[model samples]
Target: MNNHSRRRFLSDVGKGMLVAGIGSNLAMELGISNALANDDANALTFGSLEPLVDLMQQIPVEKLQPALVHEIQRGTELKTLVAAGALANARHFAGHDYVGFHTMMALMPAWRIAEELPQTEQPLPVLKVLYRNTARIQEAGGDERLHTAEPAKLADTRRGGERLLKDMYKGDMQSAERTFAALSQGERSNAYNDLQHLVQDAPDVHRVTLAWRAWDTLQLLGYEHAHTLLRQSVRYCVEREQERLKKDRPEPALRKLTPRLLDDYKLLSKKTGLRKTDDAWVEQLAQTFFAATREQAAEAAAEALAEGFAPEDIGEAMSLAANLLILHDPGRPEKWASPEKPKDSVHGASVGVHASDSANSWRNIARVTNQRNLVCSLLVGAWHTAGQTGYITDSPFAFDVDVITSKKLDADALLAELNTAVQAKNQSKAMAVVKSWEIAGNPAKPIFDCLRRYAVSEDGALHAEKYFRTVTEEFTTTRPEFRWRHLIGLARVSASEYGWPAPGRDQARDLLET
Candidate 1:
């Protein structure tokens, strides 16, 4: 074809009809007549001819037409999705309902596709996932798909997953309709309850796809939900990758296990791995994966993997996701440190966490439902620790590097310096003293030592025993140089009247007490 003729497929006058809702590449392959190409649906184009099209085109064209709907994410559906998203955002500001925030955010994007961006719509793959798990709605002898299930039942089962439980209790008489209904509802759950339900048990191809969409949707609603979801994905991908490894390794190690299911599973897993990460290699390979366009993020992720940074790259990928969450919520650190601010910033003798809420000590920031952020942090932290330690044969936890600085860093006198800084409300000096040990290449032990000698007793105004223990762990596990920065970040949020290096100035003396 001449360049001019070939270009006709793109020219305004020669614009070809794009069969959008359904991804049928067969129509493109059978040499779709140039006559019909410019005749119908607007000049839209399918991103690529996905293999799923092979199954799609097999159905009679008449039936395929009914299957496809030129669905637009406008009108009543648009209002509902936007309204629900707004409501979820409001609930999040209340400070106690993170899960509720995520839930309301997850199930709305099916109705809110963005304009002028080539974002992969989540609804289609979600449909493919449903098709794989549910009983065939296509008839045996005929082509018509008359199996229309109840929309309300499907919606209810998905929102709470209550229907799945009810169906299971029926012992021998489970309803096939209900089973399909339950599978259909699975999209909204985020597998928040059971990680495997999405990563392993659910259709393999859709796991990350589902996560990214929900992650994208929540952020669009202007709530800081992606970081939590990113943390969850790190765990999900690790576990799923581990399972894939075990299932695919050739022979012998199978011990008492079967090989048939294992082999097919390997093949299926490989196909899934290819599809999920393929786009990541081609386009925006480096634009800060999460914040960039979808194609860009995928390409960046692929480039990272190709550069021999697998497994760890996932953590690095997670780092991008974490940045998005943190950047979105400037006050999150302070909120995490002490969620409930005092009525008027008044200090009762000492500015500190209320003794009444003391029973909930340490405020274990690791949410039970999603510990991915904590786990991912530990992973990065260890990597940071080893690099600082010089990666020797007999690996010591802390490095021996003597970071150069203008000021003298006397380790033995750190406590006195810390006290001096805190008393003067000098955030910079106080933070520097606390961080000096880290700069000296052995922070964990010294930080712990400082806490042991000066931290007030069990019920002290500020509990450095517990807080210091966590910081010690962070020092030992995270990037050596950055560990102190994390503390500084924390202090930034938890600042008291005396200033932030030590929030609750009155109680600040408790931590520095000799």
Candidate 2:
């Protein structure tokens, strides 16, 4: 544990990252693969080794409560406006929807990463090389080739892949149903095992748990929307799994390295009573997603562990999360909102509650603004408390950085167009402007203008306020997609500022009528 060894360890990491640098044109592989941590005696661990666990990894591990608290205070706005309110209302604004949950879902994890490493040796240089390298491959269209790749990275055989999404999006319901039905439970189970292993072993569990804890924090504060939370929170897991799969490792190697137990499952079980449990964690997670009393969600998670739900249960949960991810890839966050076409519905039904089946079919009602990012602070907190961060996050490049180097967006003009769309109650149009915004390079000023003008909740307002003004201004060469997503939500909230609801069943169908 001397400086000499630490220096060597970091140097080795740098070498691997350099090999995987942006110039290599290979999709980046995340995790501490082939790193010296395996050899090092003093490997750094995240969360706590004992009872006073970071739990949500929010305050203790991530020191994220301030950020969450800050976001809640700054972003909230009333229908009619007067800047943000004087004081914050965490409970009032927490469950504003998936957008807020998603914002934190992404934000908290990044913060946790920053918190994990030693502040003295800023690791951005190392992470930059790896992220840039991986992004190069993705940008070059290599990562998506698993279906056609030489090794065929991971198998999607019976479960399904993006093809199912295309079918659904293209209104091929018959084909979609056949594909969904064709998924033999056996194949699904197998795939789940692989995915579960991925979840238990993936390096990004730190980030995923960070996001999960963020969900619980939101729910505990009062933001709960069950189906929406489950649907979206799963995306974080998908994000991690995708990042892992992009490395194009073979199945056998993955299985070999993948931990059979995330840790001493028995020890974890005894500590938190979460051993050999069932879908209790699912329900525990649901209480928060559904926005139950903090007490209810806490009790549920505790009870699940008391019943013996261990990481295997988490593996099953990851399987479901992976399926949801395939159903909706994390890479294409933009697709979350395609113009809702009535014919897209199979039987004029919506997959979730309160969704209008006026068109009479199973439809993809998911939108970026779905606002169900179930921070899972409680659920994740339980796991984080029971076990370690379950991640060897000693590397600098924990995630792909979307460096902010693009053309500038005209804050005033974009706002004008965005305002017009919102005032017009044109959901599609407003969405278009948000997505189509050539919002790049020094766009923070304009981004903030939108935040102040139309922030959906205090959380969104706060996050946007600080990020645009501070993070973008301070950091360089990072993925601005998170910002883009945030801005998109701001636009949606702005558009809905005057009570313009997301066009309901019959109303949405009427779009074709016009």
Each model's lDDT comes to 0.30, 0.29
lDDT of 2 by residue, 277-325 (tens): 3345543443242333323333444444445555334323322221221
* Candidate 1 global CA lDDT score: 0.30
Which prediction has the highest TM-score against the true structure? 1
What C-alpha RMSD separates each model from the true structure? 24.5, 25.3
Cα misplacement distance, residue 69 of candidate 1 (Å): 65
Model 2 ranges off by over 4 Å: 1-411, 438-442, 456-478, 500-514
- Which candidate number has the best lDDT? 1
TM-score per model over all chains = 0.29, 0.23
Q: Show where candidate 1 strays beyond 4 Å.
A: 1-299, 302-308, 316-409, 419-425, 448-475, 479-484, 487-514
Candidate 1 on 145-260: residue-level lDDT in tens?
Answer: 11223323443333332343233222211242334334434442333333322222222212332333344445343333332233233333334444555577432221212123
Candidate 2 positional error at 131, Å: 47
